[model samples]
Target: MSTSPDRVGVPASDGSDTVIDVAGLHMRYGPYEAVRGIDLHITRGEVFAFLGPNGAGKTTTAEILEGYRRRSGGQVTVLGEDPEHADASWRARIGVVLQETEPERDLTAEECLQLYAGYYPAPRDVHQTLALVGLAEQANVTATRLSGGQRRRLDVALALIGDPELLFLDEPTTGFDPSARRAAWDMVSGLRSLGVTVFLTTHYMDEAEYLADRVAVITQGRIVAEGPPGTLAGREHAPAEIAFTMPADTTVDDLPDPVRAAVAESTSGRVLVHAESTLHILGPLIRWAEGRHVDLPDLEVHRSSLEDVYLALTNPDAHTV
Candidate 1:
């Protein structure tokens, strides 16, 4: 979406229909460049994931979009206002969730939300927000007494009390256990029903795959890849792997010559074929295997997962241990 100078803080007539529009974004700290020439386009109500290893400029870029920090250079318009110059009304249209907020030990879950609700001019019903985050049962429970997962839900409740049009979820499930993480994923998934645009930053690849409509990966201050979770970094075009244990009484040489040619690996009585086209390579092999009356019980079909593609896109050496 292109920005119109006259409509910097409102809907535009420049044929632009995006919630966030960034072009040539850059952030500098002293002599070091953090975010460099990143371009992003996020439409309204879309769930977008920004992923990268540590110190890859994700935080800096998010802060810039949130209006907490000023960028050294770039054109950033979030919710129709340049975040750097955004006012209170613009901020009211967005919500941000950190790992956790300061403990509201003296307040109950409902009270905590009520206090935050007062901050917004047109707040959502406190009860509805509590129920939406699955915290209705804990409404009267003191914030400090809630379980870790429950506290996280309260964080989400606080963020939602304002009925924000855009939400920034920054590592919302950072330290959650497996069950807690899954529960959090479900809650985040429910946001789609609300029609609120979500900007999610997470370390879990599965979380991104399950939640994001599209994902962008950053490395060394640049966007290296961006696409749907299933096809990021050409994952959809990656070669398929056809794997199985070696058939008894059969050697690689004994297989049909066509199938043998597809064999990329054979070791420890196991064989793997990297098939550009699974059916063409697999048909000949399966026919040959069944002809010998053999079962390929351990056979598995595989593709490069999101995590695998992510690893291939970023440099491991650049991440801090």
Candidate 2:
């Protein structure tokens, strides 16, 4: 869909409604360019994740898009307005959950949300916001008394006080335990269910896999790959890995043909199979083992995960090891 008349719409390359349109974005710190000509289009109501190693300029690009930093060059339109020039109304429409914050130590959770809600013209109910963020039980608790995860939830609740149309979550689950991280994931999923667009910067691949509709990999100030979490770097369709413990009697040299084409290795009590399709070789491997009265132990099948693809695409040199 097209944006405001003067601001031309980015033609949807992947058939998605554009919420953030950026082209040739650049940011520099003195003589050193942190971001060099990056282009990305975040679709409406979709979770877009930005992944990169340290010093890859992911943060710089995200800051420019969030209006926290000025871009040295290139076109940036967030929700159809230049983020750098957008006013309070524009700011009100966006929610941001930063990495860290030290709010007033004395304020209660309810009071905190209530205070921030006053700034927005149409804010969500404080009590409801508190419950939505799983902080209802801590409503009356002092900010300093809350745990790190609870404090992070409070940050999210404050960001949602404005009932924003777009949300920016940067390393939201940084210190969260597994359950807390799952809770945060559910909250993000809930926001998307309400049609809130999300721009996320995270190091957690599993979190990205669970929440992101699409992921972008940035390295040395450039987007090397961008697509659905599963499909990035063509890994969505990459082969699966099958591994099982073979009986002590079966040796590598005794394995059958055609099936042998998919076997990556076989030694002692273990066997590893790499195949384009799991169905093609799984049954054969089982039957072959059974026919020989081989007792297979701990059979497992694994596909190329987002983490694997991320490492492969971002640091090709490291994969050599």
Candidate 3:
């Protein structure tokens, strides 16, 4: 097969064909409803990430999209066809790397890839697939003999053997070390360069931030927020946290007037200010410390991060009480 990928689907708003669309989707487990009327869209050649805590129905929703589960209600379309009714041809165009995959323990990685490749009409070269996932050296090793990171790479290689137009990755780099994780990121970047649509789920905010073009936060079986990684869940404008050690022999009462006023109004009692720029508060803090004849000690400033946004949205009930 040619290395150049065929164009898949597109987005709805831009007049391009949508790759995946879900409208008011719901899934039930007898008495309980897991997915509660959720809607989402994924465009062609884009990496869309889904973030949610355990039991928030993220996996349920993904399985429904993959045609593994029948929906209780609502509509779901993958590659412009209803996932529930799609045939084998539709399945051939999409590759899925699920969280828990157990190959025959005695089978070598190369053998496993070769076995799966036979099912596809136009699979990628086995050697190239193994190298793409950073498992080139471990091709001869049995699945039981490979390390956690190496095994994960094999899983990814199997997913790509079909040369799928769209790929689904569930926690793709969960067990990888730092270096291994970076390698996985590079591999995903290469996939994007080839114009393949990637849908992934990851708990590591940094991973999602690096890989996903757009991310959606699902909470209580609903999408609380959806946008680009930087702006999702209001992370772009969230307040920064500032902490500094008080000067030696200086009591809170001895602080400068302006500094004392600001500190007094702070509920945290540590001069926490919600400001756009840290410098804005730093200037006043430094001047006040000098006027009070006390030296500032160990100042630190940190802005809102994606982790903060995730915790805020996923655990709103914790904050509510």
CA RMSD per model (angstroms): 5.5, 5.8, 4.6
lDDT of 3 by residue, 1-321 (tens): 333344332222344658889999988898888889999988898999988777788778888888899999998888878989987667777899898887667889998988887777667899999888888888888988888777777888898998887899988887789998998888888898777899888778888889999998887778888999988866767666676666667566765554455442333234554446556667888887778777656676777777778887888755520
lDDT of 1 at 282: 79
Worst 10 residues of 1 by lDDT: 1-10
TM-score of 1: 0.91
- Per-candidate TM-score against the hidden true structure: 0.91, 0.90, 0.82
Report the lDDT tens digits of candidate 1 across residue range 164-266.
Answer: 8889998888889999999999999999999889998876788899999999999889999999999898888888888888878888898777678989999
Candidate 2, which segments miss by more than 4 Å at Cα? 1-16, 290-295
Clashing pairs in 1: none
Error of 2 at 219 (Å): 1.7
Cα lDDT computed for each candidate against the true fold:
0.85, 0.83, 0.79
Tens digits of lDDT, candidate 2, 47-135: 89998877888778878888999899999998878999988768878898887787667899888887887777777889898999899
Whichever of 1 and 2 has more TM-score, that candidate is 1
Error of 2 at 81 (Å): 0.3
